[model samples]
Target chain A: MTARSLDWESGQGERKWRRRSLWALLLLVPLALAGQAYDSVKTLLGGEDLFPRQVAWGQSAHFGGSDWKLTDLRGAFGMSSLPPDSVPVLADFSVKVGDPDLQKLWLGCKVMLIDAEGRRWSPTSAVSLKAPGDVHTCVSAIFSGARRGDTLNLRETFLVPRQATKTIRPAVGLASERPHFLFFQLEKD
Target chain B: MMRKMANVILLLLATALCYGLQVSKPHYAELIGPIPAYGKLGDAVVGRGFEARAAKVAFSRNLKVDRYGQTKVFTTGGIWAVVTVEFAASAQSTTVAVASWRGPTGLAYDQTERLSFADGLLPVAIDPGLPKKARLIFEVRPDEVSNATLLISEKLMSALDSQAEISLGPVAAGADGLPAETVDTLDLTQPI
Candidate 1:
């Protein structure tokens, strides 16, 4: 072949290789970003309440390596001690232990009421209500040290707007199970 | 050859611009730092979660705190700067947990830990619709007391959260070069 023809072929080959490398680099950019953001994305998804595992009221479901049944969602309104236009709500649950390692699995336990408008009300200490001695809060239950198959009653109190009491649903979130949490449907609604 | 020289100069300018941009960029911590809500001493500074108003400021050499019928006197090497602030939660029940006294020289003095057992200290729970008065005590140099700013927030690491910054105005100096309002002792047992 002629020298000019050989030079043209070699140049074409080099251009093709450069094009392929450019495409590979375009693909590597996202891969590098994903690698750098893997931990942050995982933490954002796993540490927040993004997804809900729905359970019918009065039915038991397994969550966070334990069997949980939401027993009641009641509201007390117009209490002399509570603030005006607010209602104090109580969410009761009975959880049966399976793993019995609550300190690890149930760390940062939260039981709150979420409304249809996406507003959430965390448990408040403003409402002073009497409960049975065996009933413990989600935080207190973690340190209760119950054995396997032992059932513990948990209670949480939230002070929310009176209008929110109608549309609110009780939810339970454990550090190990988030962004997947147990959302219970109210029987009255 | 002239075009090539122009291209080189353009590239050098671009590099210098990039370097300047990088050098002038804020630090990562400052980029995500607290959003400030500024106000004067008597003005109510409303943040996203709470509202704070600095009603008064006092200087003292000793603090007498009474708890459980026992009076304990706490002395400070420097002067004690006491700022009486009224805080109210806006939407929910929250705690005003952190406060600092920032001097004119940009030095920040955190609320004194010596008054942790004193009643009405910070980290006090504020309820919605109810305003509560609390004291922020800081042991700072006598010279740094003037032109001080009081900063209050919900927590210590309040990134991207609202922080109240109240300018205390200038303090008067006495004949001895100390704050003119400095008292020998201040009793914390009195209701704020």
Candidate 2:
């Protein structure tokens, strides 16, 4: 039990703690860098969850400033304009867009078609053709200039290649915004 | 200390190499170039050129007739070149509109205002297994009347995705080179 020996042991203990702290700090640098890289890849590949909110088919959901309900969805391969290969999917929905505080609301929202295999397709066009029935009749209402209590009937059609196991849902949002979606799961017919 | 310095330099070099490799990869646009979907009048241009066909094209200096039978007179100094097309939206449901028009001088013009005469197809919705006929109108300087080219597309917002261009032959001009007040039907159904 000499003073010099006691001082040496204490010094050794101090050095060990210092080395452990340095290693811990160095480990954090790589972890932080790996997290950043993962985020970059997700963003680049559009791996971000576009439709965080999902609604059942024929169910109603509200986002931004409007109530939306997708009533019907149909898919057929026998479109004369789509060649013999492509299939056309139609989605019918009702929207009542109006908030007293909001001056002008645009209901001309865009839609994305997500198939069973998780493939996405933007509609080739949104149309209002006159046909017999509630679904076929053209509704001449613009969602962008909606006033209080304005209800619009609309449908969007998307064309994709025909597949045996085709199932789909409609992802709705403003025409040019992202990370905001009101998804609808519609029955595949 | 010297070995530590050398190791740091090697890491820097490796980072630089990875960055160089990432940047050198070809971009999507550069690798694929532009998508081509060219077609003449009367031919069925399907998706990207699919089942949709452009038929019975008629060009007029003045918009005397429209889809709704509304006749309009242009007050602006420029004359109107109206293109009436029979666009058949064949099998699949889709959107159709007059994307733009290119003058003989290579200047481009979009559909003119929907004054008295309806401008182009009004972004109409054509159903599956059906045909739709629509008109597209453009206002251009009187001198740009002759040899104007009209481009029709499923949706202007996605023009690059699907489109067809037709060559509108010369329009009859008056003494001052302004367009004459007459309708001329040209066969642009054949590719130029």
Candidate 3:
């Protein structure tokens, strides 16, 4: 009687294994397709909302700052033999919301100017991602122009997000998607 | 027993379906254009002199010369390469000369102009041959040779692979060797 019970248990275990294998195989195809569909949809509709806020930017004395600040205007460039005052300046960027799933929003811009005498100057800093909810960016640069003159130096920075941070109500079992606009301009101001 | 088995299968299938769908967003480069002509530059300017002038960045993977403003290479009506710089004065006299860039191209298509502490900005328009707005070396000329400060910017090649630096001449007294006149220079090239 004990031997018969052992044989019965072995058969039951094998049957369980077979059933589990069948289930796994049957669901794999559908699961894979679902994932692909989700990614495609998110690509079409913004997946998230991200806001640019003031964050601490660790900068050196070469840059205009004490130790830390909420600006990130380190324009990327080669400095192998950069003569002094060789800060390559990039202007403001027009950042619009693309598509994505996000939780917050971040935006900023770099502004620059050149006065009359050819004396380079980087004044009027912009607010950073940390502008007390509204963002206050500051732009600074290490200056050394002719003893004194007229021209002022200028450069600006701008950042955008892959997705909009603002949320929308769901509809037709569809995801909510929208585009945002950021006005980038330069004037006497 | 059969009914229980079917129910278990459906539950597993449902779980799989729910876990399958998710999305991501795309980011685009800022299309900020028309970088206007600034009256002054970033900070105190380096005095005028052809610090260095070698050859154009001969080759690269994806070289870029930014034209902070200005439309296309030659679209801005009478656009030109604008340069600015600051330099030390010699109680003694001196003369500064800029170097010239030599490339496969013929007569380097660039021009030069100098402004003073009282002149404010020295704007010199480039010919239609030059790019509207970009920065870099122009025709074998050292960055600058002037009686004051100078900045030279140029734009070359639209190809991805193109980069290098130009070694310029020294900042010394002219033939006279008198304290010498302060000079500055700048380059205007294509947005390529």
Provide chain B TM-scores across all predictions: 0.96, 0.60, 0.19
* Number of backbone clashes in candidate 1: 0
lDDT for model 2, please: 0.59
Off by over 4 Å in 2: A1-189, B1-34, B47-72, B75-78, B88-94, B114-120, B154-160, B170-192
TM-score of 1: 0.78
> Distance from true position, residue B40, model 1, in Å?
3.5
Q: Give the lowest summed-lDDT range of ten residues in model 3 chain B.
A: B124-133
10 residues in a row with least lDDT, candidate 3 chain A: A164-173
lDDT of 2 by residue, A55-84 (tens): 886678775466778887777545564445
- Compute the lDDT for candidate 3: 0.27
- Tens digits of lDDT, candidate 1, B5-123: 99999999999999999999999999999999999999999999999999999999899999678998889888999999999777655789999999999999999887788888988
Q: Give the best candidate by lDDT.
A: 1
DockQ of 2: 0.05
Interface RMSD of 1: 4.4
Sort order, TM-score high to low: 1, 2, 3
Candidate 1 docking category? incorrect
Q: For each candidate, give its TM-score against the true structure.
A: 0.78, 0.42, 0.19
DockQ of predicted model 1: 0.15
